[model samples]
Target: MEFPSRDLELATRQATLESDTPQIVGPQVVLGQGGFADDDAPENALVAVRDQSQWYVADSLHQARELAGKVQGRRSSLEPRPPLELPEGDWALTLRTCWVEPAYLETDASWCNPQDEPADPVANGGAFGGKIASDVTDVARELAQANDRVVRVLWSREDTVRHGPKRPPVSVGLRADGSGIFRLARTDHIDERIRPLLPKCEIEQVTIPGPPTSSAIRGAGWAEVEMLRAGLSGQAGWVTAPSGASAKATIANELISVEVRAGSPLDWVMFRSYCIGAAHMAYSWVTSEGLSVDQNGDVHDLTIRSFGVLRSSDTPEI
Candidate 1:
């Protein structure tokens, strides 16, 4: 599964031509899945172990405690697994959806194919990138096909953080007055990632080895870039959604105010909550949070306590 850099360049070019769309470029590789396993059945792990180079078939951290008596602290050695084989795709394809929220359509529209359920973007809202749970649906469906039994695929917070896709870490340089000089990252498709949002800024690519990084998380990389650009430009940052939905906001003295226009929010509470959550996430990510990795591309800080996140008092109320 890979969304190559060249493809992102093209997506960005196309997105650049249309100013109304969100700068949402993605991996050349899409994890394509179906259902919940039986409660009594053996639980499956869905994680990508960095050192072992393995993905999606480990014990969830929540379930790790239960293994204490069974394994008596016994641990297995790391053994690298080969990447899964998937068909090639036309990376040249591009899409633009902005100001089109309250919109969704996916799957075959027939219940006869359960495997296609996770592909339902309209109903799920896809939780930004959190909707990767669709991967589990595929795992479960495959197991059910082989053994004719329910195979539940689940993971804990630790498993998620460890294996999940991340907002690509960036290297941004700014002048004394906040004008950006360069924003760089190997994990991101820089062509369409930040440049589209901050048209005046420049970005360079720096090679670095690590686990998968992406723009799929909530607002992801573009959010941070737009916010930074907002500070530099002394104006509200512009935002667009895949659904063609859009919003604008400005931050002064650490306070944020947003105005949105998105096809009439269907549910006020859900729409408000979703926007608030994303705002909080974007604020936290741009202002206080970051991940640090060691020389071997291993993340030294694994526990939540080590993430050094902003305290509740630090977060402003709307």
Candidate 2:
């Protein structure tokens, strides 16, 4: 028997806007049975927590948290931040202090035994690109081998907020003809990723003292540029992803309208749910979410409550 071609196999799995299948892992996740990284850890796994610049292994999560509290970090002064300067233009926006807390419910977690490599930190759920460079796996391996036992490393909410990568803040000025200066927090090769999106705008990366920024974060630089362009033109346009998925969104009168075309959407219900979640997140990011970094490069809004994520009641209909 002859095997089907790759294209033929993929074509057989096409989906439509009307498809109503559930997400593959929905039930398991909803029932709390999804095998998260920490779930299947060894029964005698040593919990590793970070205290200031040091790592501490504890008998339990409560004890680990208590150890973490022993080295309480400095609080921000909340001083008035200096303003960012942009060249004069028709539509200039100086967004010096913008930040996004990923706030992914599952913090960075990893586990390892002396005889094997570290388990994946993102075994289940997602980090929204926040855990791409997380050091927890390496730490787990080191601790497990050093202690000659299974070890699990987990970051607390505050630890996640302090160390997770952030979307780089922007300062921009746009002319009537769509030519202007785009300034962003410095990150390696970020300008290259953003240059194509803002070909008409001069891209300049500036060094800022705060949490490290990542170009890998969802739409880090390009999204900001697109929003700036839309605000300047008073019109929103189609946004196309590298994978050919495209969407156009508009918000007016407390309602959000979106049109998306993603090939082979497998499950329309899941797709729609994700889109609605993205809409809510976008709304929250614009209306309330932000991080306060002081002059000394410390993140002041460390707690989950302080991020100002929108409550369900405050979210607009999508």
Query: TM-score winner among the candidates?
Result: 2
Give the clash total for candidate 2.
Answer: 0
lDDT of each: 0.43, 0.72
Error of 2 at 297 (Å): 1.1
Candidate 2 positional error at 303, Å:
1.6
lDDT score, candidate 2: 0.72
Q: Write the per-residue lDDT of candidate 1 for residues 1-318, one digit (tens) a residue.
A: 232224554554333333222333334224221121222233442221112232232344334234322222111132221111111332221111111010111221101122333212212124345434334455445544444433334433343344555555554555434434443335545457666665654555555544455555555556566556665566774667555678876677767787787665433443465567666765664455544454455444444534445566778876
| Clash totals for all candidate models | 22, 0
Tens-digit lDDT track for model 2 on 69-134?
A: 754444344532422456566664434447667888878999999999997766654466677778
Kindly provide the TM-score of model 2 when superposed on the true structure, using C-alpha atoms. Answer: 0.85
